[model samples]
Target: MATEEVNKPPSLPPYPEMIFAAIAGLNESNGSNKSAISKYIESSYGDLPAGHATLLAHHLNKLKESGELVMVKNNYMRPNPNSPPRRGRGRPPKPKIPLPAGAVVSPARPRGRPPKPKDPATVAAAAEVGPVPPRPRGRPPKMARPAGAGPVKTGSGRPRGRPPKNKTPFAVVGFD
Candidate 1:
């Protein structure tokens, strides 16, 4: 069982480790430039799949944000030794700075379809930003009757029933 577990392949690639290794392996002077890191990864392992570059970039960017790596110009670099090491990940502390009187901090939007703003003040403020364009109403204005092509005879594909011949009106439920 132990050997089987060890032999089993990972369902997903270890992207974080790969990205970190690629960045760390860079020469101090190179500053872990993105292209260099990507090339290194390809050479060491295999080509990344289509649309994967963005995901890989996100990982690298997170490292830079967390102070695990430093960015200089277009390249990322090792953090300075003098600065204290970054803390472990968890909820970040809230801002302690106080807002001036009359400041309004908008609440965080919930995930998925956002609710419309109902507050009159918020509505007025939004209106000031730009003129609200009129919405399209009813059926869309169709193309000009195809330049004398004549109106399309509308109705189902069924043929019209034969007309009654007798002068006396027969019971009729429908019309063509």
Candidate 2:
């Protein structure tokens, strides 16, 4: 009787699958050079949809942080094979703006001289005008009724004018 070989499904790696695949491919192809790994990753995955490169960079950084990968000079990174080394000095410190301790900053004062006084003619014209009277505060004064006119009677139980006529004619009477 022939023995049947059992095939097992591959297990997923704990890290990001794409990155793991990329690292494995790089190791197989280039024998584990960081530059080669970087080149392979760029060539294989860099042309993916726009945001994928950023995601790939983030995953690669996470792998490096977790001691699963190592970055070399010139932006090259590969699967870590040795003890994690301390990171090199990062970008130089930004130029410092040193403020003195307990410094009190006051509001900036106007820079130039006061504007020149109004022209002589304008000043004289302004001086001739008297102070304006204060306006009455509440609603405006009601309109005045016409002189010698009384209020006209309206509907409250008072008789209105003649009733309206209908289209039908009443009996016609001829009078000489």
TM-score of each: 0.39, 0.28
Collision pairs in model 2: none
Q: What value does the lDDT take at residue 138 in candidate 1? A: 91
- Candidate 1: which stretches are off by over 4 Å? 1-13, 84-176
Cα lDDT, all candidates: 0.78, 0.62
* Backbone clashes (count) for model 1: 0
| Residue 101 of model 1, lDDT score | 100
Error of 2 at 74 (Å): 3.9
- Using alpha carbons, what is the TM-score of model 1? 0.39
1-176 in candidate 1: lDDT tens per residue? Answer: 99999976545467778877877776757587888888888787765667667877888888888787777888887777998777657987987998999999999878898777599988889888987788888988867665788867867866688766869768978977
Cα distance off (Å), candidate 1, residue 168: 99
lDDT of 2 by residue, 58-163 (tens): 7767877876666555342454466556555788568888779998878898998989988999788777995668999999998987877887556786567876
* Candidate closest to the true structure, highest TM-score: 1
lDDT of 2: 0.62
